[model samples]
Target: MQDEEQDRPLLGRTVGITAERKAAEIGAALPRRGAEVRDGAAMHTVPVPQDGELRTATESVLAAPVDRVVVVTGAGFRGWLEAAEHHGLADRLVEQLTGAELLARGAKARGAIRGAGLVESWTSPAEESAEVLERLLAEDLRGQRIAVQLHGEPMRAFRDALAEAGAEVLPVRVYRWTDPEDLSALDALIDEIIAGRIDALPLTSAPAAANLLGRAERTGRGEQLRGALREGVFLACVGPVTAAPIAAAELPYAMPDRARTGALVRLVADRFARD
Candidate 1:
């Protein structure tokens, strides 16, 4: 059975994975079906610099139980726990959140919350943060204290919206998705993509896709790269969020109906098999 499975269609194809947090796991999944994974880690996850900003937020949450807590991303949720652990307050923070109404932007955040032994009071449909805020606004939120786990990008609009609805919002920005500190290998990967050296690319986040294109654009090879993607190279994104930039660029790509890692991989495998 193992040998038969190893003889799968992707046996000699090269797949590029640009995920950061679970880069290894994504890469590992590709090989089981026989695809060689190229490490295209354009971004790295880093806890918000040891600056007191993150600590202060966690402290505030513990000081007074927030009326409602909104978790934006799984990565952000995990990052918060990690940062709190550094301050020896992970357990306390988790305990403190028990009394608050927890909301998740998507399944990812819900997963993180559950992993921490916390239950989410609700989750937004379509995994959109805006939907979560909109749903909360329909109800009475006057004087409600809400804590939001920010995921890298600035969501001033989200904060402002909550405030307009009469909710005091406290943003707990735990970590950011930043470009890799070292650019030594990025150029090579771009070159390979242009040269058609890679067969497929799996993007797990919008930022990673944007960063990859930004780097290519800086090198004056953006058009060529896009052409490559449109012509032969397969670009597979985890979901609509990750596919948004690719779509905006007018590039052709494939994505599964559900934004899950396994589905993304299967979509890629199916694409390769058809070709």
Candidate 2:
């Protein structure tokens, strides 16, 4: 504790993490290195219902005329299929997935689609909604209907972009994150961000950024959070792919050359001196 305090006087800089897992691996990386991490990781382990609305949704999509399907979240695809399996819909679901042209938002989404014995026709260059829209615009889907699997929060812009390009876009909202039933940790993190008591954030996912912003709004710190991002907090996303959310914040951000955690840490150390 003493070493951390001495090493990171910028302990004043408190950054928060809202990751899928406990962020045990990445949480330890931020301390005393000039960044104080707010271990507000809400593990994205919401049980994929063995059978429920999710299964019904999956069955609905499977039964629909899916000419092309876009897999945005790898975990979402797995959860969706898992839910369907409990209802004895895996074989048919697999069959439904067979003929559609698969579009992957990035490596993670691609992994999920391939795991289902499928593959992507094109993977988003930047693993973001904007990039995905650009890819679709270039594909000439004048009248074809495309299925976009919703990842976390709904991206209205993504669907709108596809529709503008003359493609009938059908979105599948498979899974979404809810704040940890206990909101104290999340609350404190938002407070720190609003106060600009943070130098950098180790952003893990787009939803993390969205969720933080949402929380700030609920607590009446929306402007405060945005200001912190612009004037104080230096966001360091895991990869260029992961930079989308920060960029969407319209806040200045720094990202690593590659989509790797080690690279992100190194990039931070290289650019910012130990304060």
Q: Pick the candidate with the highest lDDT.
A: 1
Clashing pairs in 1: none
Candidate 2: deviation at residue 240, Å?
Answer: 8.5
Q: What is the C-alpha lDDT profile of model 2 across 1-275, one tens digit per residue? A: 87655555455555567765537666776663666667665324465355565665676677677778878778888877777777888888788878788888778889988888886788877665566677677878778778778766567777787788888777667776677665777787777777766566777666776677777887788888788778876778775445666676687888776655666666665555444
Instruction: Give candidate 2 regions above 4 Å deviation.
Output: 1-14, 31-35, 42-53, 125-129, 194-196, 237-250, 257-263
Q: What lDDT would candidate 1 get against the real structure?
A: 0.83
Angstrom error of the Cα, residue 71, model 1: value is 2.4
* Each model's lDDT: 0.83, 0.71
Candidate 1, after superposition: displacement of residue 274 in Å? 2.3
lDDT string for model 1 (1-275, tens) is 55544456687788877777768778888898889877767777677875588999888888776899999888789989988888899989988889899999988899999999999999986676667878889889999889999876556777898999898889998877788766656677778888998999988888788888988898799999898889879899887667777998999888876666888888888876765
